[model samples]
Target: MLISFAMRRILLPVLITTGLAALLMAAACSTAPQPLEKKSEPTFDEGEYGGEPLPGTEQVTIVEPSPGGDRFALIRRRTPGEPSDPRFQLWIVDRDGSNPRLISVNTHDVAWHPSGDRAVVTVAIGIDFYVYTIDLETMETTQWTGKESQRLSFPVVSMAGWFRDGHRLLVFANQKAYQQPFPRGLYVIDTRDSMTTGPLVKLFSTTCLGNQDRYTVGKKYVRSDDPSSGNFARYDFDDESWRWITDFPKDSLRFVQKPVPSPTSDLIIQARETGNAKQLFLMNHRGKDVRQITEFGGDIPVWSSDGSYVTFRRDVHRGEGARYVPFKFNLKTRKAEPLWPVSPDSVPDFPDLSTQTLDKLKPRR
Candidate 1:
């Protein structure tokens, strides 16, 4: 009897201690931090052209998305089998790849109006290019620039963007005067009245930040100034003057290009070269708080209309000649994701082509 009581007392304490240890371990594990579940990358199928497989000789490039993010503009080029002029086609489609329609043929460049109801397209004939406005609702096109003889003579003309009011178009052209050297400058044309074109600046190699009142123009060539340096300025439409924003330095190593302002006009995104690779950077409008955004290397970083996202072309293969894949970066999440499929074979197949026929397409005037 004495031995049995002694054994029971020892066994009870041991069982109690063992149970407490397991309970403590379970509590710790339940309260501990858990690893985050990895998210699968979003997949987008290759887009079709008029519900048909994209030809091998055709290349499609996404230009810009509308302000409302409902529609986007793209450029399609068809390379000829023989050595002849390649065909350029401009297309506009919804974000979901619906309502794919041809806007114009032989279009050089295009920019969407802020209202997303129209687009400004540049058409080239021979050596001359003219700007025209297309009403998306009516599909009626109007030549914003006057007749060929009265229009400014420039070997190249590009549509920049619309002013804050969306009534005027900002353009960049090369002005070739009689018996004088050609000069490239930025000019603004009133859409309501195309006859009124006002010169904004007299600088070469200039580019405007779409949806913003700012532009980056090449600096005056001085003996001491670096030949690659450029100037960023903001245009005041009220007074028709430019206010200097900052200077983008050019050196033996890096060349700055495409300084685009965010939709809110508080941030700017630009590309800079380090060694042989180009990377994207984000900075304030005043040229402060500069920080690198990408490390793999990207170019042509264009902000979304709402400033919520940025789309850029990422160099996937360095050995290849400028081979690129498109990606989107979310500002809120600070994450980069693939925007579209990299390979042409991965493009999604269309279910029905009955409604999407090229016969209904109209030619550009």
Candidate 2:
């Protein structure tokens, strides 16, 4: 009787094992690997800028003034054909909507020269920084890529503009090769000679982000004993001198938009940060005309031809929602009014120069 009981127990366990094996085999056969459903890549079309046209503006760019009167230059990124990977193509409206002409297809960043006859741009593939000159007359593009590597460098050889002479171009080539440090300095490139100046000039060499001192082992973005502040400096090639604009305070918020130097090189109109707000300020040739124009603290101020009005986009952050509000400011009345269909995804269109700065609007010092 004991032997029979043991045999029964063994048979029961064997039967359970056989059932489980059969169930597993059936599941494996039923679930043969299926081919992956190819995911269609997101496509960005040519006219697909994510914003409505500003009211009274037909997707046209706003024109600010330069050295000459009524010189219009607009830049828009368009992937005209069926896109594999998107690249930015520049278009210029030199005659103000007469006919938009294609400038270059491989351009990454483009800015008109003070003369408004040419442009300075950076063209990069993956890690290379190639500074190129776009000739407006011939629509011919010339690139300068030999001096630097194309690594994912920080301070990214961005911020190009015509110097005081309009004969030379200034480029900020980021040599750090990473995002950890601020840009090393400004590099002055002669357009005619194609000669570059230096690897350092003390302009934006400090931390752009406000946290710099807490350099611990696991800490990110904190440099050891970094000043936790930023300072603006200008290199005078003529005098071989360096000047300080200001040392950004720790508790104070500050940002320097493009430094728009005057025709006479005596003043600069800057988009700056005050506390949590961004506003427009004009600095005289002596760098002292720090007067507040409009108080729409969140938007950037782009000057108009006569410095009479400025156009900008404001970001309104409300809890989980955000809205991009386009605005135009009249300087004489000190009033800012909203423009067009409001959307959180809308952004600023590339601005161009329509009229030139006549005279410094006597600084309100």
Q: Could you give candidate 1's per-residue lDDT for residues 1-365 as a string of tens digits?
A: 01234332321111233333332233223333232235542222222101222223234444577888877676655332323533566777666545567666677777778888988887776566667788877877866543544344443556766766888777766544344233456666776656446455665334445334544332332222244445555554456556555543333213455567765446667776543455676655555556555656666677777666787766554442434455676665556666655434211122223333332222232
Stretches of model 2 off by over 4 angstroms after superposition: 1-67, 77-89, 94-98, 105-108, 124-128, 146-156, 164-166, 178-183, 199-229, 250-259, 273-277, 285-289, 297-365
> Model 1: clashing residue pairs?
46-347
What tens-digit string does per-residue lDDT give for candidate 2 at 143-180? 55333332213425654555546666556644455443
Residue 263 alpha-carbon offset, candidate 1, angstroms: 3.0
RMSD of 2: 25.0
lDDT of all predictions: 0.54, 0.42
Candidate 1 Cα misplacement greater than 4 A, ranges: 1-62, 77-87, 146-156, 175-184, 204-206, 209-230, 238-254, 341-365
Consecutive 10-residue window with the lowest summed lDDT within model 2 = 209-218
RMSD of each: 18.3, 25.0
TM-score for candidate 1: 0.66
Return the lDDT, model 1, position 353. 30
Among all candidates shown, the one with the greatest lDDT: 1
Q: Against the true structure, what is each candidate's TM-score?
A: 0.66, 0.53
